[model samples]
Every structure is written in C-alpha cells, then in structure tokens.
Target: MKFAVIVFPGSNCDIDMFHAIKDELGEDVSYVWHDETSLEGFDAILLPGGFSYGDYLRSGAIARFSPIMKAVEEAAAAGKPILGVCNGFQVLLEAGLLPGAMRRNSKLTFICKQTELEVKQGDTMFTQSYEEGESITIPVAHGDGNYYCDEETLKNLQANNQIVFTYKEDINGSIANIAGITNKKGNVLGMMPHPERAVDELLGSADGLKLFQSIVKHWREQHAITS
Candidate 1:
C-alpha cells in the first residue's frame, strides 16, 4: 500500500518514517508537505514526530491548523488508517482525531530513551502482527508524553479495546501507562513512542516492523490483493 508521511515545518522524523516505509517495508511512500490539501491517492497517512511549528503553542497546537490536516481529517472519516507518533500524536489530539490530551512529563523533563512497551490489543489494523500481551522496546523522546482522558472516555477505551500499548515501567506517567491508543473506529492511532526509529536491527530492535506490517496486511486483505 502507498503511504504519505506528512511534513510540517519542524517535523524532524519525516525522513525516518519515509525510510521505514520505503526501504524497510518496501512500500510506495512519499513526503507530503503540510500545505498540500489533497490526500487523494494514499492508502494510509503517517504523522511523524517533531516540534511542529517549533512547538510554539504547546506541542501540536499550531500545527493542527496546517492546510493538509483538512485532508487528513477527510481521510480518517473515510476509514483509512492514520498513525501518529510522538509529536504527531499531539497533533492528532489537537485535531480531535484521537482521544485524550498530553501533559508535561510527571518529572517535567524531556525523557529520551529506549523504553519497554506492552501490546495491549493486537486486533487492530495497526497492531495485528503483534501477539497479545507481547513486550517490545521502542525509543521515546518528548517532554509532554503523559496522556490523560476523562473517566468515561477511559472506560470506553477499555471496553472497546482501544488502548493498544502501555508502558511497562511508567516512564512518563501516562494514565494506565498508555503508550498508544486507537480511535473508536480503529482507523487512527496516536502514540508517544518512536516506532520508526526502532524498526532496524542496528537500532537495537526490529519490533516496530510488525506494526507497519500489520497495516500492510490489513490493507491487502481489505483491497483483496494477493501480493
């Protein structure tokens, strides 16, 4: 499947994401500047991590207004999968595409390190390659990585199996140790960790490869392609 990695001014992980998809996953991928409004032919959308708009107005606050986000919203509405990593997660929240909000790390510091993450639900299109309850380590780098949601939303997330990944060691104090979560429709995922950075063996692990594979497998199944 083809993918578009959205690029915003201050987005630093766009290249990493493109490499993961194009080189590692062997998929058709391209960089889409944040100003372009039409995502007419992409099968999936990826929002990579970075200090978009220099994080000037709180993580993803300003970047949410990018012209391309309109197209992203339209894509999400059409049931195409969207994955947001790190600051991209912040933007999805600000754009109202995902649930919850992020706050300063409990320690109020930018924590950057490899961290353990447990697979909470492997049933979705983005996580099906992982076994249920599998443990994997991925790198995380951010100051506002803590996630919070209302009690009702939390309950719904639990009931719907939308909580996909949880930190095994509470590295950022996210509620329920949430490292990643999916929208109710399972078409959008927002997570704090950098999976793209961990997709290579030289990077210390290839656990993140399964997440991308899951998306491709799901797309092929939905489109009825044998390749």
Candidate 2:
C-alpha cells in the first residue's frame, strides 16, 4: 500500500519514516508537506516525530492548524490507517483525533533511550503481527511524552481495548505506562515510541518492523475483500 509521510516545517524524522516504508517495508511512500491541501491517493498516513513549529506553544499545538490536517481528519473518518509517532502523537492529541494529552516528563527532562514495551492488544489492525502480552523494545525521545487522561476517558480506553502498547516500567510517568494507543475505531494510532527508527536489526532492534507489517497486512486483507 502507498503511504504519505506528513512533513511539517520543523519535522526532522520524515526521512527516517520514508526509509522505513520505502526501503524496509517495501511500500510506495512519499513526503507530503504540511501545507498541502489534500491526501487523495495515499492508502495510509504517517506523521513522524519532530519539533513541529518548534514546539513553541506546547508540542503539536501549532502544527495542528496546518492545511493538511483537514485531509488527515478525512482519512481517519474513512477508516484509513494513520500512525503518529512521538511529536506526531502530540499532534494527534492536539487535533482531537486521539484522546488524552501530553505533559512534561515527570523528571522535567528530555529523555532519549530504548524502552521495553508490552503488547496490550495484539488483535488490532496496527498490532496483529505481535503476540498479546509480548515484550518488544522501541526507542523513545521526547520531553513532553508523559501521557494523561481523565479517569472516565481512561476507563473507556480500557473498556474498548484502545490501549495498545504500554511501557514495562515507568519510563516517562505516563498514565498506565501508555506508550501507544489507538482510536476507538482502531484506525488511528498515536504513540510516543519511535518505531520507524527500529525497523532494522542494525538499529539495535527490528521489533518495530512488525508494527508496519501489521498495517500493510490489514490493508491487503481489506483490499482483497473490497476488490
């Protein structure tokens, strides 16, 4: 399936995302500037991590107003897969495409490291390649990666199996150790970990490759059915 890696002014990881999809995942992929008005032909959308708009008014706050986000919203509404990593996750939350919000790390410091995560719901579209409760290592880098949600929302997330990946330990003090989560419909995923950075064994781990494979696998199945 073809994918579009959204590029904002300050986005620095667009190349990493492109390499992961084009080289590692063997998929058609291209960069879509944030100001672009449409996402017409892409089968999936990827928002890579970076300090969009320089993270001036809070991570992802200003970047949400970009013209391309309207197209992203349309894609999500159509049930197309959308994966947002790191600051991209922040943008999803800011855009209200995903629930919860990010806060400063509990330690008030920028952190960058490989973290162990548990697969919470492997049956979902973005995680089907993983076994339930399996442990995988992915790297994370961010200062405002601490995730929080109100109690009611947290309960809903739990009840709906929207929580997909959780940290094995308190890495950033996110509630329930939430490293990643999907929307209620499971079409959109927002996560703090940098899965694109781990698509190869030479990168220290290939665990993140399964996440991308899961997306393509689901798309192929759905395409076969519809076609």
Candidate 3:
C-alpha cells in the first residue's frame, strides 16, 4: 500500500512516519508538503506529530489552513483512511474532521513518556488487529492533549463505538481518559499517542505496528489485493 505523510513547516515527525511505513512496513510512502494541492494515488494519509506553525496560536489552529488541508478535506470526502497522531489530532479537530477539541493537560504541563492505552474496540480499520480491552504501550508527547467534548457528543461516541483507545491511567486528564477516537465513518482516526514511534522493538515496543497492519489488512481486503 502507498501512504502519504503530510509535512508542515514544523512537522518533526514526518520522517518518523515515513520510516515506519516505508522501512518497517515495506510500503510505498512519500512526503507530501503542506502546500501541495492533491493526494492522488495514495491509499492512505498520515498526519504526523509536531508543533505545526510553531503552535503559536493553539496547537493546530494555524496549520489547519495550510493549502494541503483542502486536499485533506477532499480525500476525507472520498473515504480514504486518515490517521492523525499527536498534533495531527489537534489539526483534525481544528479542521472539524473529527469531534471534540483539545485543552491544556489537566496538570497544565507537557507530558512525554510511554503510556498504557486500552483498546476499547476493533471495529475500525485502524484497530482491527487489537481485541477489546487489550492494553498496549505507546509514547505520548504533548502539552495540550486534553480531549474535551460535550456530554451528548460523548454519549453518542460511546453508543456508536467511536472511542477507539483510552488511557489505562489518567495521564493527561483527557475526558473519560480517552486517548484516541475515530470519526463516525471510522475511516478517520485522531489520537494523542504516537503510534508510529512505537513500531520498532529497538525503540522499546512494537505494539504500534498492528495499528498500521490493521490499516493495510483492511484496505487490501476491501480492494481485493491478492499479493
């Protein structure tokens, strides 16, 4: 499968994302600049972590307006899977592609460390490889990662199984300990944790590999790719 790793001016994780897919997963991947107009020929889109636009005015507020975001909207409308990690999650929220908004950590500090997350469900293409209630370790680095949404929205998300992952412990003070979530259509996922950073054993854990594997597996199944 081919993946496009969107790159903004301050996208520090672009290379890491590209490496995860290309080097580790052995997939065709490319770095698509934030100003690019189209995402043609890519099976999936990955919004990597970083302080986009220096996070000057809120984490993803400014970066959401990058020229490539228009194409991102178009791609989302076309039903291509979109995975946003860390600041990417903030971008998705700011762009209105996903539900809820982020707030400063409950502790009012930047958090950087390995976190345990419980897989709530495996219905989406992003988590089909994980079982319900399975716990996995992934690194999270963010200051404004606290997730908040209205009670009604949270209820709806729960009823629809949109909540994908939750922190095993209350680390960031996210509402209901939510660590990750998917769009209503399940093709788009936004999360505070950095899954791409955990795909290698040398780095510590390979738990995040299955998230990518699930994407490729589900995509191939849908496309009937026999190879």
The candidate maximizing lDDT is: 2
Better TM-score candidate (2, 3): 2
Give the residue spans of candidate 3 off by over 4 A.
225-227
Q: Global CA lDDT of candidate 2, please?
A: 0.96
What is the C-alpha local distance difference test score of each model? Answer: 0.95, 0.96, 0.93
**After superposition, candidate 1 runs with Cα above 4 Å error:** 225-227
Q: List, residue by residue over 1-227, the lDDT tens digit for candidate 2.
A: 99999999899889999999999999999999999989999999999999999999989999999999999999999999999999999999999999999999999989899999999999998999999999999999999999999999999999999999999999788999999999999999999999999999999999999999999999999989653
TM-score of 3: 0.97
Which tens-of-lDDT digit does each residue in 1-227 have in candidate 1? 89999999999999999999999999999999999999999999999999999999688999999999999999999999999999999999999999889999999988999999999997999999999899998999999999999999999999999999999998888999999999999999999999999899999889898999999999999999466
For model 3, what is the C-alpha lDDT against the true structure? 0.93
Considering summed lDDT, which 10 consecutive residues are worst modelled in model 2? 218-227
The top-ranked prediction according to TM-score is 2
Q: Which stretches of model 2 miss by more than 4 angstroms?
A: 225-227
TM-scores for every predicted model: 0.98, 0.98, 0.97
Q: What's the candidate order when arranged by decreasing TM-score? A: 2, 1, 3
